[model samples]
Target: MSRAKNPKYESMSLEELRANMEKSKKELEHAIHNKNILEQRKRIVERKERSHRLIVKGAEFEKAFPLSRDLEQEEVQDVMEQLQNSSYNKSIVRQVYIAALHKEQQQIAEAVERAEKGDDS
Candidate 1:
């Protein structure tokens, strides 16, 4: 047999209804407080993300503007133009440009091979 519903909810006096309304209001207030806390957490995370993006952007800007190189800008540009025209393996180009003794050259070749194999430290 189905149980009967509570009479207080089914047909309450005015005072009883007001009491129930007050209870509902308190629950609603608690929910609003929790929502505000969640919103504050979201803002904190968003701020952190924005800060990380700014840091990355700053690093990129520095790379594109290497400090104290202004005196040699023209010469650097000329070499850069030559490198662009050469169409060389740019990754190993720095090592190739530095002349070395025979033993050092052998070591460099081995290092490059290892690096290409994803094994170099």
Candidate 2:
């Protein structure tokens, strides 16, 4: 049986790269429809490698490529505001609130890192 070379497209030839990108795009669209976190993450990693290849090849990649809406700024802000204003037992709320904050921070950090690296994802 033949092996799957790699899911990453950066080091692949042009045809392989395009195929990988198309696969990623379709997976992303499907993930959007079904709201699957695993598919969404697979898309992120695949597309990020695609973007890196485009950069290396001097292609003009679109800056406004659609991003997944799962962890948007508005949602994070709403969660933060709710955590701050809601009255609850400190012992109970603190751990949950801190966990949410940590998750939000990780999402923000990932987004910023992707942005800095020129991946519009």
Candidate 3:
């Protein structure tokens, strides 16, 4: 991207300089538009991926508790509240939460190690 030294700028007419300024403005506008398109597409993909994940999770949940498919939302919430109120279920929930957190930490540590190795190379 290095530009070669030229004496043309010193001798160029005012009109020439104005044309170059206009060209730069157009280039800047196009660059911004291109970046905005890419960002918009990225957001669209993220939204679609999230929707797909939720659909998959819903299907799995329905498979596990077929009766839940017929139950109202309030009923489901009520059932979950009761489960949480029970000490046994509460303990189990905490254990599951801790396990998930530990798994996430391990994954992050692994990623950091991989990144460090890459940097070393």
Candidate 4:
């Protein structure tokens, strides 16, 4: 609470203050509900984006290894493990990761430059 009170509130009748407090409480609850809905929508959009990326990766995987499409989850895990165990695959993965990192950095730099120029969306 504040040490000082507003004269407006001090002059309000007890019933009027109670009504005003209830109205404020309802507005706060409504705002909280709206915030929760927006958060939920954001989570859903994130999940959808992740799902799309996974689906695209799966499609790419199937294109690379057609026979593996029919395999079970454990088999896929085994294949991934085997790939990871291979030095050639590890090197390839590293190269791809580095390329991706560079691309991301370039994109970020471009975005920053745009922002500096006040042209960023």
Highest lDDT scorer:
4
lDDT scores of the candidates, listed in order: 0.79, 0.73, 0.90, 0.97
C-alpha TM-scores of all predictions: 0.45, 0.27, 0.64, 0.83
Candidate 4 C-alpha lDDT tens digits along 18-113: 999999999999999999999999999999999999999999999999999899999999999998899999999899999999999999999999
Q: Is candidate 2 or candidate 4 better by lDDT?
A: 4
Error of 4 at 43 (Å): 1.9
What local lDDT does model 2 show for residue 66? 30
Tell me the tens digit of each residue's lDDT in model 3 across 30-109: 99999999999999999999999989977887898899889998997887688679999889979999999999999888
State how far residue 60 of model 3 sits from its true place (Å).
2.1
* Per-model RMSD to reference: 14.5, 23.1, 5.9, 2.3
* Model 3 ranges off by over 4 Å: 1-10, 71-95, 114-121
**Whose TM-score is greatest here?**
4
Tell me how many clashing residue pairs each candidate has: 0, 0, 0, 0
For candidate 2, write residues 44-80 as lDDT tens digits. Answer: 9999999998675433212332332354768656755
**On a 0 to 100 scale, what is the lDDT of residue 39 in model 4?**
100
Per-residue lDDT tens digits for candidate 1, residues 4-58, read: 8987588888898899899999999999999999999999999999999988965
Residue 3, model 3, lDDT: 86
